[model samples]
Target chain A: MSSVPLPSSRPALGLIGLGAFGRLIAGPLARHFPVLAHDPTASDDSGIEGVRLTSLAEAATCPIVVLATPVAALPEVVAAIRPYLRPGVLVLDVGSVKVVPADVMRRGLPAHAAIVATHPLFGPQSAQDGLRGCRIAVCEVRGDRSRRVAAFLRSALSLDVILTTPEAHDRDAAASQGLTHLIARAMLAMEPLPTRMTTRSFDLLMQAVEMVRHDAPEVYDAIARANPYAEEVRRRFVAQATRLTTDPVQERDRAA
Target chain B: MSSVPLPSSRPALGLIGLGAFGRLIAGPLARHFPVLAHDPTASDDSGIEGVRLTSLAEAATCPIVVLATPVAALPEVVAAIRPYLRPGVLVLDVGSVKVVPADVMRRGLPAHAAIVATHPLFGPQSAQDGLRGCRIAVCEVRGDRSRRVAAFLRSALSLDVILTTPEAHDRDAAASQGLTHLIARAMLAMEPLPTRMTTRSFDLLMQAVEMVRHDAPEVYDAIARANPYAEEVRRRFVAQATRLTTDPVQERDRAA
Candidate 1:
């Protein structure tokens, strides 16, 4: 309900990763606080205009540092930044699945430093028009910083912030993101799908299919493997599909 | 490219089934020609206006009769109307699958009755905004009368008409319609799907799922079994899903 009260002297917002998703939020985030980014893979921040390029150590010491690294790289990134993190520095992770990254942050970061796990549900593709009204799942791990961040997201970015535990967020996300990517990948494997004379139902499926078709293979893997609930959901989906296809009596019914 | 030449005496368009789907097309068809419909299940034509209630024989005798009966009841309806169809009378079918219904018309109707198989891709739910710009697959079996009907559909009804063979239509439809319903039914089987915090991709899947969830079981059966190509498509889809879910390495890859 309350807005994120800006500090009298605004501190630089640190961004640890500069991948597609990281760059997407950088511009908007830069508007609120001066952004300083560090990406080991990039030689320079030529593409990202609004944010300044800085070393990992410099970015880590900022008042608010966002860890935007891949899920598998979380532990190493957390360890790398742990020594440089100053007391009361809020370390936020933008991981798709929160539980593991939240755990990694807790284990690596010092007790003096704050940790928060957040997943902005929209990507560049889904948020092409804008990020207003987008949903962002927030999991407050070790501080009251989540309230300030949630308020900022709601008031400044116009985001729908759902405050939840890391476990609940991953459970719900496993079904949503997991099943979607699985279906999209499977559909792409069945390419040259009939383009003409598509019914509205088939068209809707195709719309979803096209959205995630070009996603990185690693994204697919993470959703399928990292999220504890994904495997079970995938198993149940496949099992249902198998049962429906094999049933002879069910297939023999006449169409309306 | 040409408009249907309106005859000086506009003969009434006969509709042989007055179900929900039948009633959907009745209002539009009545605009071109006075519509007289007959349904064994209906006591009167109270729900749909612009269509008069008539006996089966009277409806069958019209210059243009649309057979909107269920796929299972097509044979009996064909036999019942065979005696009433006069020479040069155009008989059309609005069935979902073309092959079986086309064959039914060819085998049961008199040689003089011109048969045209049409599958309007949109149903009552999809056609709520009206039939303009909807896709309709047409397979002309026995006459040139289909050309006139196609022109009428394109010009007067503002329909996108795709002229195709019964075999081709059924083959493409098996993949399109079959895959959609299969996914919807399977998703429904996995009930209590997360209602909140859905991604765009997941929301699109749910939209397609909601569209077909209330469809008749017979419709599902017909698409699954009646269309010869549906089984092969279903088999491939299930096999792909199975392989993806089972591959451990694929699931373990880290997301970018």
Candidate 2:
């Protein structure tokens, strides 16, 4: 039942979740659509004022709904929003890993709705300046709207849109993102690292750590554990590290 | 004998052990002082052309001598050059680790000689463009020439000069440089990493690897082995990595 809106029409966009990433994208997205934002944790004490806040049902009634909640909460969010989603509503998700969230959205969303799963390859730290060069991976889950979405991302937002399936994105990301977070975590545990006599390479490595050190704990959880291929990548990394640390060839240099 | 070469007067400077680092500094340094370079392994077929390469004795007889050899070779080079050094000649070393090499140059050379132990904290890779902002640590070993050397480095090359003892330089560098090379080595073992769909942090981390990946094998040997504090740093890094890899609490996120 999910049908295309008028070609030139811009309908309201319902944004669910009000975390750091939620606020980062809301302002830019408001340019194209009237955004109705909702967050379960936002209250009088929360600093979520200024944006147009709405109830869950009202947000779901919009022409487009984006689930910005954590990946672990995707299933519950999907289930809660199901009863209120209008026919022809397009649902999208912004999460770190794609495969699990894509499946959850596909299984729980109303059959009449169209689903496009996306993983914006940047965060508040990386996109602090702007989103001109940021990349986002878009996968068509339940409908044919992903191409149109990717086109809008390229034209309106100046985003580099990579159209890939859930499996492919997770596989490549397991090695790149999974290893990055793991290394950053290990380094953070060894804080007060030397800043005085550092080489250029060490400076670069520390900058990488700075980018992800303040991220929410769940982000690390998703990259290192929630992703399907993360365990295999971690196993290979730890194995190589063990070999380097224990090898007798390395020992010969110790007596040099 | 190296008397005060007179203010604003530049004399011949000898440079020993012409490796990658030696060749890097020779051109810039030659602009200030007449350079005579010596490398024991250089042959006619080697790419040691276009520079004034001379015998070890001839190079060591200059008013000032610099040792650009690996730290592991510092003691031997110090012994071999001792008989040729002129009275009151100023000697300097550019090595990754300082304490051992500083000790070697101190004990082996004649008491009349002046010694300044320095680490350039950079390489051909980091200084590919220029050395305007690069850092060099200068430690006074035998005489008061380190102050003059530090001032010269500041005025001529625009280098950021850090004056410290060999022990302080090695202690900080053991944590910073030692871990960088170790991480780069571990990542190189897992090559063919994903170039597509990489996050910005991963890109920066890979750039760090590119900076040090092609460095000479002896560089790693010296940093990891010749430095006395490097073993403790490596042990701590490995222990933290092991705990992260095996922690039971992290397994809960796996079920998410």
Output the lDDT of residue B16, model 1: 95
Ten-residue segment with the worst summed lDDT in candidate 1 chain B?
B247-256
Best by TM-score: 1
* Model 2 lDDT, full chain set: 0.85
Q: How does residue B32 of candidate 1 score in lDDT?
A: 76
Candidate 1 Cα misplacement greater than 4 A, ranges: A1-8, A248-256, B1-8, B248-256
**Using lDDT as the measure, which candidate wins?**
2
Query: Model 2 reaches what TM-score against the true structure?
Result: 0.91
lDDT of 2 by residue, B1-256 (tens): 2232334366778889778999888888877887778887876432433346778888899899999998878888899999999998999999998999889888999999999999999999999988888999999999889889999999999999999999999989988888888888888889989887888999999999999998888888778777888877777777777766666126345556
Q: What is the DockQ for all candidates, taken in turn? A: 0.58, 0.57
**CAPRI class of candidate 1:** medium
